[model samples]
Target chain A: MERLPAFELKRPTSLAQAIEWLAATPEARAIAGGTDLVPNLRDGIGAPPVLVDLSRVPGFDAYEIRTAGARIGAGVTLARLASDAGVAAALPAVSAAAASIAGPGHRSVATVGGNLCVDTRCVYYNQSEWWRKSNGYCLKHLGDTCHVAPTGTRCHAAYQGDLAPALIACGASVELAGPRGTRTIALEDLYRDDGLAHLALEPGELVVAVAVPAQPRGAMSAYRKARARGAIDFPLAGVAVRLAVDDGRIAAIDVALTGTNSRPFRLAGTAAWVGRAVDDGLLAELGKAVQKQVSPMRTTVTQSNWRRQVASVEAQRLVRDLAKVAS
Target chain B: MAKRVLSFVVNGRLREEAVGDSTLLLDLLREQLGLTGTKRGCDGGECGACTVIVDGRPQLSCLTLAARCDGAHVETVEALAAGGRMSALQAAFHEKLGTQCGFCTPGMIMAAEALLRGNPAPDEATIREALGGNLCRCTGYVKIIEAVQAAAAAGGGR
Candidate 1:
C-alpha cells in the first residue's frame, strides 16, 4: 500500500485559523476533503512539507440558498450537493453533474471545491512518479516535451472536472481567500485555457465558496456525459446545455463541453446556430457545429477522433432531450 | 505528526480515541475497536469493502478520516448480528447464495443495511443503483439483488 510521505498535519477549527496557518507555513497545503490531494500525496505525485486539514473549519461545510442565488461552501461534499433538494430544484444541471461523478463512496468523500481545484490529468501525466521516472518524465512533471503531443510547445494535459462545465453553464461564480483578502471571480475566469497553467488561482489561495445563480423561469438545463462505463470513470466527453425558452422558441442557449480540451469550452457559436429554432434539423446542425468547435486533443482515455465524435452526438442528445422536456 | 482525539458512538456504544491525522475509519474499526467485520479491500473509495453507516447514511470507511466522524453515530456489519444470530438480510444472503468468496460480503451487507434504512421497500432498479458502488466479481450480482429484494419484502431485516 502507498503511504503518505512524512509531513506535519494541522487541523484548524475555523477558516481564519486555516488562513493564518497557510500564511505562516509557506510549505503547507490546504486539504479540505482529501479526496484528491491524499491520493496524489500517497502516489508520490506531489507532497508538501505540511498539510493544513480543513475538515474542522467551521462554516465551510454548508450550503446556503439565498433569494438571489445558492452558495456552496468549499468543504461541501459531492454527496451533499447531489442530495440537496434546493440545489436540485434551482440548479438541476449542477446536481445532475454531481450525481454523475464517480460512485456513492467517492461522492461522499469528494468535495465540490476539491473537484473544481483538481489537477489537470492526462494518460501520461497521472502515472506514479516512479513510473514516470522509468518512462522519462513528460512535460507536465519533469521533462519539457509533451508525450501526448510531441511537437507541442507546452503540456497538453486534459482537464476532466465534472462540475466546471455545468457550473459555468449555470453562470456560477467562485470566491477565493488568500494572503490578500477575499475576491470573487466568475467561474470561467478561473481557467486560463493553458494546460500547463490551467487555473488562475494563486499558490496559497483557497477556494472559499461557489455561488450559482437561480435558474430563470421557462429555462431548461441538462447534462450528458459519455464515459467508459456507466459509473466510476471520468467523462470521455460531456456536455451541459441550458436553454431559455420564450413563447415555445429558444431565447438563449448556453452550451459547455468538458473532457474535450485543457479547460471547459463554451459552444457559444453553436448556441447561435439553434437560436429561435425548435425543429429537429436546427438541433442536428447545432450538434455538428458544437463537435466542430471542440478540438479534443489526443490525451483522454478514448481515442481523440472518437471522443470528438461523441462530443457532437452528446451535444445533440442534450438539446433534443431539453426540447422534448420543454415541449 | 499530531494525533487528534475522536469521540463518537459506535454501534450503540460511545467510544473515544486518539488517532493519527491520516487514520482512516476502517483502521479505527478493525485495529482500535476490534470490529473486524468491516473488511478493507481497496483503500480507495472505488471498492465498497469498507462501507459503514455513519449518521444514518452509508459511507466508505476507507475514504473517511477517523476524526471526521466526531459526534456521529456509526454502525458496522457486526452490529447487524443481534443475540448471536443473523439478521433477515444476512439470512437471505445465505439462502440466496449472495456470497462466493465472502470477501465482499460484509461491505455488501452494510450497504444493504443503509439502503433498507432509507427505503424499506426498494425495487430491483433501486437495489442495483444502491449497490452499484459495491463490486462483486463473484455471484454476478443476480443473487445479491434478489436477496436485497427479498429482505425488503420481509420488511428489511425484521
Candidate 2:
C-alpha cells in the first residue's frame, strides 16, 4: 500500500482560532476535506509540515439558504451541496456541477472550497514521486523545464475545477479569512491563469464561504461536462450556462467554460444575444462562437481538438436546455 | 511526527487508539483493528474499494485520516453481520451472484447498506445512483443492482 509522509495534524474547532493558527504558522496548510490535499501530499506536491483540519471548525459546514441567495460554507461537502433541496431548487447548475464531480464516494468527502481551489492538473504533473523523478519532473514541481511546453518558462497546468464555472455564471463571490482580515472577491477575480500559483489568495488565507446570489426572476441555469469515460473522471470540457429571459426574450446570458483554459473563461460574445430570441439555430452558432474562446492544449489525456469540439457540443446542449425553460 | 488519540465508534463499539498524522482510516480498519473487509483499491479516490459509512454517509476510507474521525461513528462491512447471520444485503448479494472478483464486495455492500437504510424502497435508478461510486470490474453491475434491489425487497436489513 502507498503511504503518505508523516506530518503534524491540528484540529481547530473555532474559525477565529483557525485563522490565528494559520496566520502564525506559515508552514501549515489548511485542509477542509483532504480529498485533494492529502492525495497531492502523498504524491509529493506541497508537503507542508502541518495540516490544519478545517472540518471541525465551527460554522464551516453550514449551508444557510438566504432570502436573496445561498451561502455555502467552504467546508460544506459536495454531497450535501448536491443533495440539498434548497440548493437544488435555487441553483440547479451548482447542484449539477456538484453531483457531476468525481463520484458518490468522492463527492461525499470533497468540499466546495477544495473544489474551487483544487490544484491544476497536467498529464506530466499528477503522478507518483517515483514516476516524476524518473521522468525528470515538470515545472509544476520546481523542475527547470516544463514537459507540456518545453519552450515555456512557466507551468502550463490546466485548471479543471467543476464548480468555478457554474458559480461564476451565477455571479458568486468568495469570503476569505486571512491574517490581515476578511475580504470577499468576485469568483471570477479569485483565480489567476497560472496553475502553480492559481489562486490570488495570500499566504495563510483560507476561503471561508461562497455566496451565490439569488437567481434572477427569468433565469434558467444548467451545467454540462464532457468526459472521455462515462464515470469517475474529470471533465475534458465543461460548460455552465445561466440565462435570463424577460418578456419572452433573452435578457442576458453568461457562459463560462472549464478545463479548456488556464482559468475559467466566460464568453464575451454572450452580450450579442442580450435581447435576441434564441432558437436551436442561434444556439448552434453560439456554440461555435463559444468554442472560439477556448484554447485547450495537451493538458489531459484528451486531445486538444477533441476537447474544443466537446466544448462546442456542451455549449450547444446547455443553450438548448436553457431554451426549454418557459420565459 | 505528532501522535493523537482517535476515538470513534466502530461496529457499535467505542474504540480508541493513538494514530499518527499520516494514518488513514483504511489502515486503521485493515491493520490496527483487524477489520480488513474494506479493500484499498486506487488508494487515491479513483476507485471505491475502500468505501465505508461515516455517520450514515458512504465516504472513501482511503481519503479519510484516522485522526479526523475523532468522536465519529464509523461502520465498516465488519458490522453488517451479527450473531452468525449475514445482512439482508449480503445474503442478497450472495443469492444474486453479485461478486466475481470479490475485491469490491465489502465496499459495495457498505455503500448499498447506507442507501437501503436511508431509502428502503429505492428503485433501480436510485440503487444504481447510490452504488455509482463502487465499481465491480468482473461483474458489470447488473447483478449488483439486482442484489441491492433484492435486499430492498426483502425489507433491507432489519
Best by lDDT, which number?
2
Flag regions of model 2 displaced more than 4 Å. Answer: none
User: Model 2 residue B53 lDDT?
Assistant: 94
Candidate 2 per-residue lDDT over residues A207-238, each given as its tens digit: 99999888887787889898865666677889
Comparing only chain B with the true structure, the TM-scores of all models are 0.96, 0.97
Per-residue accuracy of model 1 over B1-158 as CA lDDT, tens digit each: 55778899999999889977767788899999999999878666667888898888778887676767889999998888889888989988988999899889988888888889888998888787778789888899999998998888877954
The model with the greatest DockQ is: 2
Give each model a TM-score.
Answer: 0.92, 0.97
- Per-residue lDDT of model 1, residues A56-110, tens digit only: 8888888898658899998899988988887777788888999988877677768
Interface RMS deviation of candidate 1: 2.1
lDDT of each: 0.82, 0.86
* Per-residue lDDT of model 2, residues B1-158, tens digit only: 78988888998999889999889999999999999999988888777899999988888999889888999999999898888899899999999999887999999998899888889999998888888777788999999999998999999954
Q: Compute the interface RMSD for candidate 2.
A: 1.5
